[model samples]
Target: MKYVLEIENVSKFFYGLVAIDDLTIKVKPGQIYGIIGPNGAGKTTLFNCVTGIYRPEKGTIKYKGEDITGMSPHKIAQKGVLRTFQNIRLFKEMSVAENIMAGCHTKSQQKWYHSILHTPFYKKDENKYWKRVEELMEFFNLTKFAMTPTGDLSYGNQRKVEMARALAADPELLILDEPAAGLNENETIELTNIILKIKEMGLGIMMIEHDMDMVMKLTDYITVINFGKEISQGVPSFVQDDPRVVEAYIGSDDEEDEV
Candidate 1:
């Protein structure tokens, strides 16, 4: 089905403690898949496995139909899989444009020697990336702060900049961890619209988030995990109605019978 990512029966452990167990997910082109669960549900761990931050001990991770299980993170990224963290991970002292340009190196064809010698190949490629960087900045509404240090921008603006940097890699699949965290209602709404625009560009998205309203509104499908197990998965409506979801996140009203 033109899947961009296929994860099957994946599992991970930390000192014999299972962090993810038998997890399977398939992401197709232009799909926005949501990963939601309560705290400590191994959502981030799953992202790590997919992105190669932490290798899965079992099963396979396939990107673009190639097995990427345990591949180095850079190799995975070079294959057009990119992600953003829940915690802001921008270069605080760098200008907004510089931070994004850092992500463009992977796309350049010029070698370090060419750059050092100021060869035409290096300058030509450098100019192309500069234009592309401006395009991305304008696409994400960061042109006004192009020369500003990322740390000087507002929290919401900083978040946007981080996302722009990730997109600078020109990925086919974007994995976002809590992109809406810490933003006010207005900022969240803006972020929502921005995500919609990204979807229009035909990029598949896999996101780990806690904002129920955002998840309900933006995701085409939802995967609910708890304590490293996939408890429920489907559209938002079914996930919201699933009893296991309630028990895992909202807690159950019924108590155990007396032994």
Candidate 2:
């Protein structure tokens, strides 16, 4: 099976400081691939490389069999790779629907002239994108807040808006950075179920999460890293039991099970 996203022997350095050492990870269609490590473990740095914010010094990144390493961030996104930041990034003053509609711009085919003149094509495109925005709002249970400013909503709802915006771009591989960072227990549970539903859409989901319970329960496979190097990788159960992971990430067996 062709992987949805493939990173082969990839490495990134910042002024001689190793941010992401040699690493390889493949995510299949509909798979949830988790990257977990302690703070400063380079998880986000790896995300940056994959999303084209930083080009790897070595190795390659492929999406659906196409080499996309070093591609511009916008170009990568146009090619069906979209991501959310560790912190929620949304148009604070924009209505929820409008924020999601911003994402739809990537898929729009209308040119600036068409929009300026209100051409038939632009009208048609507008309808199509608005329909998509409505669908996303309902899917994320944000219909009630459709006209509300995103900043006025709770943190959890803001997160939903960001995810919905990413989905609006129609991505094949979605990269989420610390998605559950500030969510409460109940909100996190809700987000977990929402992600499982997204997996059923057959898009590969790659996430860097500090929530070990969420990682163990939600990920189809996991890569444990330490100081920019992969320490262990396997199914959740296997990685959960690996000694190296225990030493580097999960606490010792003597401690109460945290992961």
Candidate 3:
């Protein structure tokens, strides 16, 4: 398989508390990989480590065959790895279009002086990015709400706006934390469609989600972690049937008595 991201023996410690334990994983290009675990299972910590939020205590991370371990978050993002938080993080007062435009800042070449003076190149770049933003808004079906304040939109639409903003970065690997949180059935279905559309666009995705139905339907491979250790990794159906996985995560009703 053509791997886009690789993590080898990665581990993290917070003042001697182990958050991730020698975690190793790979995400192939254009594949939707799911990371599922109970709360405090170190899933978010793993995401943080991969995205440069925290440097791992050991092991290495590579992207496109280049060592990216210990890089800054901004640098990782520049290398085409972008992530969204579990909590919806939008500029409450900013218009939906403006919020997306903000995400394009890293790719924008218009310097402060050029932006202030409105130089020809600045105008050209601005127009180009604006057009791209419009395209993304349309793709996510948010064009009608483009001018609305992000905080005023419904919870589901706000989540869509977050996805659109993430797309504005044109990332090769998108790491989403609970994108389906706070959504109704219809919204969840719509979000699933958006995720599939993103994968079809050839972007590799690694998502940490608790919704098994969504994860099973959307992911090409599954990795389950419990108490900061990965218990299983394989195709969804195979992982679902693994005895260790069931024991660690999906406990049977009768097994609850033993616990």
Candidate 4:
């Protein structure tokens, strides 16, 4: 089957230290793929390479059968690929609705002159984007916080805003880095449901997360990486049972279980 994203022998390094060592992965549309590993397993590094924050030292990356290796981040994002950071990143002073509207600017039709002159077309596109922002905020349960400054919202709500912003870009593939990092159980569960909803909309979702229960519930397939190498990968059930996965990451879950 044709894949939405294909990474083949992709490698990256910093100061001669390998961050992604000949790693390969494939993601299909409507699939939720998880990347799990220890803290230094090169998960985020791989994301950086994919998003063009770092150019890969070797190998190829193809999206929809088109090679996109080493493209600029904004250029890549324009192609319907969007991501949320492991650390929450949002405009602290921007209203929740305004933040999401910024994401839609990439899809806005008016040119610089139109915006500068406040032309009728600018007004039209502005209204269109505003309506879109409102719809997304309402969908993510952020309607009440629509006018609130993003920094003033609770951490969980800020995260939801970020996801909403990413979705506002109309991504075909969404990459989330450690989306469940600091959430409480209830918040995590809610986030899980939201992610499932996104998947149902047919976006390819990839994430790097430490929360095993959340990852296991949300992902269709998972790849385990340790020290910049792939040690295990498959459906969640199979990866959960693999000895190598146990030794590397899942074993920690067992320890948490014991505690």
lDDT of each: 0.92, 0.94, 0.91, 0.91
Candidate 2 displacement at residue 195 in angstroms? 0.2
Candidate 2, residues 1-259, lDDT tens digits: the string is 5799999999999899998899999999999999998899999999999999999999999999999999999999999999999888899999999999999998787788998999999999999999999999999999999999999999999999999999999999999999999999999999999999999999999999989999999999999989999999999999988889878864676675645
Q: Which lDDT value does model 3 have at 223?
A: 87
Task: State candidate 1's TM-score.
Answer: 0.97
lDDT of 3: 0.91
My TM-score estimates for the predictions, one after another, are 0.97, 0.96, 0.96, 0.94
Tens-digit lDDT track for model 3 on 1-259? 3789999999899999989998899998889999988789999999999999899999999998889999999989878898888999999899999999988876776778998898999999899899988999999999999899999999999999888888898899999999999899999999999999999989999999889899999999988988778899999999878888777765777787888
Cα deviation in Å at residue 40, candidate 1? 0.3
Which residue segments of model 3 deviate by more than 4 Å? 250-255
lDDT of 1 by residue, 1-259 (tens): 4999999999999999999999999999999999999999999999999999999999999998999999999989888999999999999999999999988886666777998899989888889888889999999899999999999999999999888888888999999999999999999999999999999899999998889999999999999999999999999999989999988986776643322
* Regions more than 4 Å wrong, model 2: 250-259
What count of clashes does model 3 give? 0
TM-score of 3: 0.96
Better of 2 and 3 by lDDT: 2
| Residue pairs of candidate 3 with colliding backbone atoms | none
RMSD of each: 1.7, 3.1, 1.6, 3.3
